[model samples]
Target: MNRDDGPLFGGRAWLPALLIVPMFLGFAFLGVQGGTVIGTLTLAAVVVWAIRANPEGPIEIAAPGEGVRGGVLVVLLAPIDDPPVAGVLAAITDPSRREAGEPLLLAPTRIGRLDRFFGDIEAARFESQRVLAVSVATLAAAGIEVEGRVGDDDVVLAAEDTLRTYAATEVVVFAPGEDDDGAIAKLERRLGIPLRRID
Candidate 1:
């Protein structure tokens, strides 16, 4: 969902009406048959529209407080933009990393979509950056030592790049959904580092 998309059907109140009009007209014309076809088409249209319109689901990540230095790397996924996730950021981050004024790098990855083709790349990338920016700000406000944050569309590529760039002792993943496990596991195997998730 791009910032330009304007808040989930924002100004487009007529879309549902547009769908309903045909069904009503069909019912008036050919009685049951026409109404059924239009009704089916309308249902399909609504499903497609909903899939395209709705935003990503929330992924909540929280962990108990642990104090350590700058040896842990954090990779954030969706729902990190939510303010409540900030407490998790504070928990996983090492207070010493902030106290020593060290710049902790947090990589935010937005999953790519098969629906977004070449022409749609710019808008998609912009939306991804927008989401990542919010997550970064949320983490920063929690006093996490995130000096700089990186954004990527592919989760595995981002994890590989993060591992290559940072000499982190361990890894923490902030993903809170069952469907994400396979992707997270792929990253874990590629990095060859133990990836801990907040249950």
Candidate 2:
């Protein structure tokens, strides 16, 4: 599994020991003054390391090569009862597209800060399901057969998760407009597969 996909200290069991062993030895043998100095320096170094490491950095998505099957993963930002934009539909329906497993339509739960803080995700989940239902129906009407799923709140994370289970040849994202968070650019860089954005 990718390091980015794991928990912060998941595989690296030595990290805690490496960090604490020296401090413990210093405090035991060097007395209070030296131990205080060592502890302060260690704390500073840890802060610097965390900053440089950027744990929330971009997730690495493997490109779907010949080993993987072909299909499309459509990420919907909103309910789409109407037909999707031309670019999106064309990418999904293009005859020249590589064949793969069944297509999937994914909608990420969009929960507000306050609602999430209060653990009130029911509304968000409901909204995501609604998006999937409407989008699936719309795509079905267009003669495209695709399964639907609700994913994580973070769009990029949701795509990454879906890609793990579904080896989609291409990913098409439908957003109302350009997002201030630069989600499209991140997806283009990290998805590895061909990414199409319709706004």
Candidate 3:
């Protein structure tokens, strides 16, 4: 099938489509409009699913005093350990910007079933959050004051949201050393800001 003809449902559309076979068989046994009802409901469901699967528009965040603190938005991906806090801090041009405190936003993408079919999605999400929490504590122990928030896995959106919310004048993306440079570059372009990286 062409990309345009692909199912609109998120995840596996094949699962639901397979159910149609059993549904038809069962509905036939029930007699009368039962089969028709089942078919209608299934078709309606697919339509609704397609509509919802469409990507949402960009989000906007509001901050007080127009980010008077001169905050820096940090978007950290998973496996964040010993995050070069000092180096990151020293890289900032002005000491005054640090006064308001840098806000670290962890936005780890969930491992999809394609990557690990037997793994639990919730477990993956929680693990990412846990990693972010540990990174936050590590930074705090290093005497680098930071405010933290766990955000969506989409780095582009996460960076944008954090920057607006924190009123950050600059952005730093802490990604795994092995991550795709192309993706990182794309994210920077989307944010309209050249992201400083530490990894």
Identify the leading candidate in terms of lDDT.
2
12, model 1: CA deviation in Å? 60
Q: Give the clashing residue pairs of candidate 3, or none.
A: none
lDDT of 1 at 189: 56
**What stretches of model 3 exceed 4 Å from their correct place?**
1-70, 83-86, 90-95, 98-101, 115-120
Error of 2 at 143 (Å): 1.4
Q: How are the candidates ranked when ordered by TM-score, highest leading?
A: 2, 3, 1
Best candidate, TM-score-wise?
2
> lDDT-based ranking, best first?
2, 3, 1
Q: Find the 10 residues in a row with the least total lDDT in model 1.
A: 56-65
Q: Candidate 2 at residue 92, lDDT?
A: 63
**TM-score: model 2 vs. ground truth:** 0.75
Residue 142 in model 1: lDDT: 76
Q: What's each prediction's clash count? A: 0, 1, 0
The TM-scores of all predictions, comma-separated, are 0.51, 0.75, 0.56
Residue-level lDDT tens digits of model 2 in 1-199: 6653444455686685688877787899998888888988888987876666644544554456667544877789987676646335755656566553457788999889999999999999999999999887777777777778999998888887877767777788888866867867877777667887766
Please report, as a residue range, the 10-residue window in candidate 3 with the lowest summed lDDT.
55-64
The local distance difference test score of each candidate is 0.59, 0.75, 0.60
| Stretch of 10 with least lDDT, candidate 2 | 54-63
